[model samples]
Target: MSSIIVTNIAPTITEQQISEFFSFCGKISTISLDHNTAAADKSLVAKITFAKKEAAETALLLHDTKLGPTSVVVEADPTAPAPAATADDAADGELRQEDKPRSAIMAEILSYGYALSDKATQKSVEFDQKNGVSTKFHSFLKDVDDKLKVRERASATDEKYNVTGHLHDTKSTLSRYFEKALDNSTGSKIRAFYADSSKHANDVHKEARRLADMRTGKSPADTPEPELASSAPVSV
Candidate 1:
């Protein structure tokens, strides 16, 4: 199925940032940009639709890089109906909210919109560029260095732990697997790999879950799957 998303873009990023990032990944169908001028500061919100899910996923990961803050990729939830407006709301009788200060605008431009993030998932995408997950994973690798320092301090011989080795191995394996998954001529294999990997264990499972959450702006728990029914007719 094709994927569509509406992003609450970071203010600092421009339309070029979004286009360039997706162009690097693959072909795109459309990008609709809406600018809000009534506010004190200018902001751009865009809806991006991709012909392929892989392209969307790849493009979404770019959110944390140069395109971060002003760029986010939100999944279009088909099941949830639009909130209904009451009669008073439709008549514009609701109280007007206070405006945000310039400081708030600057902060929003700099921040990666983690507050809008899903707390349960703990994944965040950048707004300026298309390469945030790799950057985030690299940042996470710093923890391994801390672990190694702790291990060396505890050891009498000052021997570092295998944290770095493990990280390198994990990164290498994931790179190879990801290339294989995307090597299909017609994109079918890539989708199949994504589907099958969801149900089983492999090195990519944990990282895929992490990246998926970061890219999609949705929690890992929200991933869709075909639920097994309890009552089923079994015919011989």
Candidate 2:
């Protein structure tokens, strides 16, 4: 679970040179040439997953000793066992506070399973061919869609039933507006589209009531009104 990820590697370092550098360690997982053939402007990126952290550290130390200009960083999987604590370290109450269970950490990071799924959805929507919808981004988009649906439903219920509830729906709506605007590589046009669509949906609901009133010969003013906007923001 210990991997050596070499980035900003000097152009002079060839694939064979990198392979030889880590020859003392375990097998390499992947080595990729992420740069073009501009000698002074080339950078090689390689990922080497070792059988053990010590072996990986040995490779890093070797790089530090011989390859002075290159920069390499090691990232170990969170689920992997932490580096062995020394005897003096044992004197400390806890070896590490960040070593929470991987599942629990992932749960907190994802917050909701659908949120991660929504990221995948966004990727999909970005790469779609037929409709040019990116299927890779679809998971993320779907998760967001699910969350909005739930919030919208809750808002409608709370407003119609005269019930009190936290401002989650309003906050979620605004959060999505900002998040979409910020992350979309294209621009804020998509955010504007969503905002307009939301307003349109609410308008459609009102229009339906208008039609019903006309058919029943009732006054349009008889329809119940929407609630006022909330004043404060909410957090995830």
What's the TM-score of each model vs. the native?
0.29, 0.26
lDDT of 1 by residue, 48-113 (tens): 665544444544433433345443545553543343432321123211110111111112222222
Residue 6 Cα positional deviation in candidate 2, in Å, after optimal superposition: 1.4
lDDT of each: 0.35, 0.36
Per residue, candidate 2 scores C-alpha lDDT tens digits across 124-180 of 222221132123223334555666545644443233221122111232332433333
Looking at candidate 2, the ten consecutive residues that score lowest on lDDT are: 95-104
Best by lDDT: 2
lDDT of 1 at 146: 43
Which candidate has the highest TM-score of all?
1
